[model samples]
Target: MKIAIISPGPFSVPPVKGSSVEHDIDEVTKMIDPEHQVTIYTRTCATYPKSAVEENRQFIRFPYNGPKPYLRRIISHIRKRKPDVIMVENRPIYVLTLKRHFPKIPVFVNMHSHVYGSPGMISKDKMKKVVRRASGFFTNSEFLRRHFMKTCKIPAHKIHAVHLGVDVSPYQVAKIHYSIRKIRKEIGLKPEDRVLFYAGRLMRAKGVHVLLKAFKEVCEQDPLARLVIVGGTGYGSNRLNPYVRELKQLAKPLGDKVKFVNFVPSAQMPLYYQVGDIVATPSVWKEAFCRVNLEAMASGKPVITTPRGGIGEVVTHQGSGFLIPPKDWKAELPALWKLLWSAPSIRTEMGKNALMRAKQFSWYATAQGYLEVFETALKKRKAASPPTKQDLRKTG
Candidate 1:
């Protein structure tokens, strides 16, 4: 099975911003390589240095300036490569390109998120036009899968749900333990400080503002807490601390209670998980799949996250850690305090449980799942009639 994965616009293969998307593409490509030839199609951004192949994986680069007609450029690459199955891992634009360029191939548009109101996905009408025409579609969560089907009217069978992957083995193999104070010392954190970590895009929908508010309360109530926000700000770096600056301003009321560092490379992510007493993800919007939560849990740290979005499935409430209501919506801070001031024994137990649950979401299992989808779609493509205009109208 020779498979070609077409990642959507402006994404560098190992992705500078969204590690999950890049990591997903990397893992799937590697997994299928043993049994199948896999080629990944990603962008050559201005930032992407000269490509020198290092790992078993290869990075194939192409020029892309902006969103306009970039999909044609991608399909042009795919048609030349001639993959058994072409997997496009983003939506809208690529879907349209598949319709125009490679209408014969089994093009699978795997969607990770959907838009609501506010100038969504081309026109909802035009998307349905493509969804009606494409061979198949996929989303990472049952939540998103249902939404895509309901909103787009694509059959449930045509839309596949592939949960995103996380590497659990590295954390398991490199697992370490330390007292809260000891962990603090190791990370240059203060011995007296209670560390709360938030890593991922610093955006309003990520609920960074909400996390800042909660952390401020956590400090006012506990007096020993410090918040460390990691990962690059999501919207353009030029965008005025934007939502992030506002969060910082709110935290200024509590001196040294907040710290913000934009962009932590993926390799050093485990350290952020290791250094925190409790990890925080307060995303107000649907996160589709919270890979950071999986990463944190893999690092054997208890997570504090809001149950809204697909993360409710990712982190079980009070099971892996605590899944509180939205930070702004919640009425009580005492529960947060109890967890913050918890005894060493309780905190250690929660961390262990978090890791236990994290093991359930392995990169191996995720890769295997993707392989199944690829094989299934490839088989369908092989057996089907040469895609005709009539085939798009044929109802299941």
Candidate 2:
């Protein structure tokens, strides 16, 4: 199969933190490289160093990612390549443009998340329209698959699930130099402090506010408890993100119990994970899929997340981690505090179990899943094509 994938932002391709969507494209493209030809159309302000570009795959950057202006360029490129399959990372603004631009090819829209929760750039109604048109579709989790079906009225038959994978090997329980004490002193840990970490976006949907509230309660229960919140500024988000200010005020009465890091590079993430006694992902709204949960589990740290969207599929409460009801952090507090006070031996056992669970989902397996979809698309496309003019005369 000859495949073309369209992405909206800079090409932060494989072995890097290229956002979740890019990770999906890179893994799938790598998976099918031996059997098929793949091309990824990315939007980058700067070009990739030639030494880093892949030999088998092609990456093309464009001027504008939006449709009204970029559609002609995309059409021209598609005409030149004439790919057998089109796998687009869909956006509502580009649906009609795609309908006219790549009219005949088999287009599969990989809907990683809906625009329903996004503050701007695209509306929910617009996303629904684009999702409804794509003949083939894929989602990050079963929870998200259900959301797509419910919101867009897309039939379940057209969609399939291909969960994202993380590099689990980098994180281990071997007690490396970046141990909890090593990270604690760097972050200014107190003598009796207990660290409960929350990593990822500080967005409303991420439920960080709820985690802070819960941390306050935990602090009241045990004075030594400290919570660290880590994430980056929103991508193209206009909302006032002085969360560090708000969160500090909220945690103020509780004393020195909260700290925030706006950005943490991928290389140093495992060390931070090594410092966490228990990881929390307290999202009020349903998560499309929580990659951080898997990352925590793989790093041999127990996770506590709500059972919404595809997160429940990974963070099995009490088995691998805890699941508290949505927006009910108080109820979730006791279980979390218990883990905080538990023996190091008990926590280590849970961490081992967590790592064992995370090993099941890997990039290697994720790649294979895409191959199944690509191969199926190729077979179906071949079967559906009508005979050529020369064959029509033979049939007559």
Candidate 3:
């Protein structure tokens, strides 16, 4: 089968630094059956060629000045390819555009976040049109699938929940080559320090400020407690913004107890994960699906995160990590941090459980899920359509 995947034009197909959607596309395409011809349509990057093939997936890049021209070029190429199925990544508007051009072809919209489907970005009427026209919808989690059903008035049958996966091999290899003591010493942390790590955009929505507030109380209680915040204001962007300034201000009283590591390359994230005793992703917003939770689990570190949106679907509270309510994070986080800090055995056990859980979610499984959805949508479309003249002739 020939599959044409339309990537959200903001980033390149194989992400240089960060872009979870792009990274996901790259991983899933690589894991997909080699027999199936998969083509990814993405924005041109200075580092990569205009056209390249890797792991049986072909990438076609186009210059992206704005959404209008970028999507127009993609649509023109997609028409030429005449793929069996078209998958639009995180763009509901693109689904409508594709359906207008190839009304009979099965077009599936993969919703990685609620941003595109929200009333703020696309109106209720247009969202409904997308639901009506598109073959099916693939959400990263059941929480997001239900969200679209509630907000866009999409039918339950039209949406499918497919969870994302993590590549645990790198984390596994990192464990063998790198020691916790060495990583801590390299990062200016003492062997005795109890580290609480946070990785993601250092924005208000990510709850970095909340983590800082909680860490302040933790520091007051436990002298050995340390906080390590990793990431920039945005993906591949380290420019300090007002929110980052606010976060720095919040961390001022803590002094050297807090360490802010600017955006690290995606390849080096495993080493940073090893630097912490416990990973904290205190997200206030309803994350569609927090990849941090899976990455931390893969690194064999316990997590303390909010059960917002699809995050609850990923992290099993008390089993792999603690799922503190966002509202009660101030009280709960410090207490949980202290509990995990004091008990090394408990932390080790939970880390083991986390690794086992992480192993279950692989890129191969994720790619298979996508393939199943594509096949289902195609079969449904074929069954609904009238028999072709060739088919009628064959029957006659």
lDDT of each: 0.70, 0.72, 0.89
- Candidate achieving the largest TM-score: 3
Q: Which stretches of candidate 3 lie over 4 Å from their true place?
A: 178-186
Query: Which digits, one per residue and each the tens of the lDDT, describe model 1 over residues 114-231?
Result: 7531135567677777777777777778888887777778898888777776777666554553343454554556766777888888778888777777666666577777788776
lDDT tens readout by residue for model 3, 157-251: 88989888898988877876646567677668987788899999888889998899888888888999899999998888998899999999999
TM-score of each: 0.86, 0.86, 0.96
| Count of steric clashes across candidates, in order | 2, 0, 0
Clash-forming residue pairs, model 3: none
Worst 10 residues of 3 by lDDT: 176-185
- What is candidate 2's local distance difference test score? 0.72
lDDT of 2 by residue, 330-382 (tens): 66685567654766766777788888889888776776776677678778866
Q: Candidate 1: RMSD over Cα atoms?
A: 5.2
lDDT of 2 at 348: 73
In model 1, what lDDT does residue 210 have? 78
